[model samples]
Target: MSAVMISRKVRKWEKLPGKNTFCCDGRVMMARQKGVFYLTLFLIIGTCALFFGFECPYLAVHLSAAIPVFAAVLFLFVMAMLLRTSFSDPGVLPRALPEEATFIEMEIEAANGNVPSGQRPPPRIRNIEINNQIVKLKYCYTCKIFRPPRASHCSICDNCVDRFDHHCPWVGNCVGKRNYRYFYLFTLSLSLLTIYIFTFDIVHVVMRSVEDGFLSALKETPGTVLEVLVCFFTLWSVVGLTGFHTYLISLNQTTNEDIKGSWSGKNRVQNPYSHKNIFKNCCEVLCGPAYPSVLDRRGLMHEDSPVSASSAAPSSSSSSLSFSNNSKPAPPTTKTTAPLIPNEHTPDDAKASIGVSAEQSCSPEDLPPSFIPPLASPETDAEASVAKDNSH
Candidate 1:
């Protein structure tokens, strides 16, 4: 039967080491620390229950029925936006594979060469131009890659989020490229809900006061007092947050950028992500096409996947052919039990190095830069020279 077929499939999210919680078998994702998210729910649902129970009935009969209808719509919208922001992937970038990391380190060393024994190496920062403006991409040692433009590593989540806005405990997810729109809408609608509830509670109190004075009306319906206090206290913070986010949206900026004063005009690097038009910026942020999550958390991996096959086969990561073959999907070498040092000499490397004839060995000059290693050892240097002579 061609060596009995072994079938064992695992979900990507289950095997991931990311500091996130998975629910519904991987459909709902959130930060592991979800205490604040529950508090946010309690506050929202509690306020809604109070308003609908106490004020909505009185307002509907005496005042226009549209008042309760509008409140209900706002409440539902706020809940939907909150859930969307809380449960969605925030555009997390995958960690670099061992081979990919080795390639990057080799390229960095090739470009910058080596420093003196007493001298310190320069920081791994690369400058890239965006919209005629220069932006520096800093290397994140945690993620083992130079973070892309607008990407930042969140300490709380222990993940590099693309276009990271902020780690919002209230929503239990990092506000980032994928779910920023929903987060913005949540804050905007929540502020309106607070204002609507507060205004109607006062209107209900005044109508009751006309019949039985203000003090007696307050005594009769205690829920209005609770609703007023909750809304009154929450009003400023909610409205202020909405306004602040609106300002950020207008500038096409994030809370992270604003805090860092990235585009405050005081620094040389202005916000390159902006289009320089307020209307366009607002539309781009609010109405732009949604970005799909790149984490691939739901991808199925069977026992015989490329990831497993790559491990069982002979190591060819240091060769040109292997690099070209692995250009599609990242290899699973990073997950190996052995420590991964790009230039570390394995027993296999030593054996191959001795068995292969100098004439058969390919030169670094003939191969693409993808598999080139740093000049770390004299043996490697001698091998390179021998390969170069053969190529010539």
Candidate 2:
């Protein structure tokens, strides 16, 4: 059996600024951001509790209410953290890309070793037909073939990611095609929890005002102060998070997609994914059934499905194919593995190396400049010929 080149690095779980300590995977910052938010919430909650005890000399009556509210908030916090952990780990949908696509231009220092002076360019990528669609893709010089959609060459991971989401440091994981659902659910639940806490605290403030008499409520019920504190924190979290997510939902986009504008249809003459109603697009993404599920393909493909083969523009190259029909109601691709690199010592490469023979479709003369050897000068050739005569 041929020796296959598998990734040898450990998957990351955390990252520090300027340090390659964690995954170093180029995914999102959900886990890290959530940590900061959780910390702020804890401090706010503590401060409110402390202030409430100070103001209200008699807290006996409402102490029971405080216990349950606090418990619920704590539960939500723990649940969110746990959910984040599972979601950020290796996702269910595995990554798939051609081995050759991962070979990028590297800046090697002179200290490394003696080498050629000029820079090496990435190999010419080729498009391939998967299912039937033409997909544009890069050919990994080392690995080889078409990678999965959204798959990207991660400089840190030193490989390509299929449906690449951002690398998350907090969980030391890559958010790819598989764990997307968990990631989305975690956000949704956290948002709901924030809103829930905000509502209760606000209501508690009103209740305190009524029972203790609004005129002297400040002194009569000090716990009301704590309620207000929780209210602000929860409200802020809900508003900020919900607003950001709402916009993403409306466009059926992801944080990465938003950043990259992969689905913006910016360069294209017409935005195929642009929908008549935002809700219609959102509904399909969140509740409808589809490979792209509306959200995935929003910026990439037209929504209502291409009318015919000619209607959908053919991919510029074979690497960009996406099967012929986007609306075929087909299941997502199950084959999710990167292509393998060919052995250097194999007969195929050996034959091409010595100019003895050429591989099919790959002419040696047409190889890129970097792959060609430097020409020998006339003076060096004459010396070599004289040395051979002397030896004889």
Residues 114-178, candidate 1, lDDT per residue (tens digit)? 78799988989999999989999999988889999999999999999999999999999999999
Q: TM-score of the candidate numbered 2?
A: 0.42
lDDT per residue for candidate 2 within 166-224, as digits (tens), equals: 66543344555445444455556555654554555455556667776665766655655
Q: Looking at candidate 2, what is the lDDT of residue 301?
A: 21
- lDDT of model 2 at position 274: 36
Q: Kindly report which residue stretches of model 2 are placed more than 4 angstroms away from their true locations once superposed.
A: 1-124, 128-135, 139-146, 153-161, 167-174, 213-227, 230-234, 269-392
Worst 10 residues of 2 by lDDT: 293-302
> Candidate 2: lDDT over CA atoms?
0.48
lDDT of 2 at 267: 58
* Best prediction by TM-score: 1
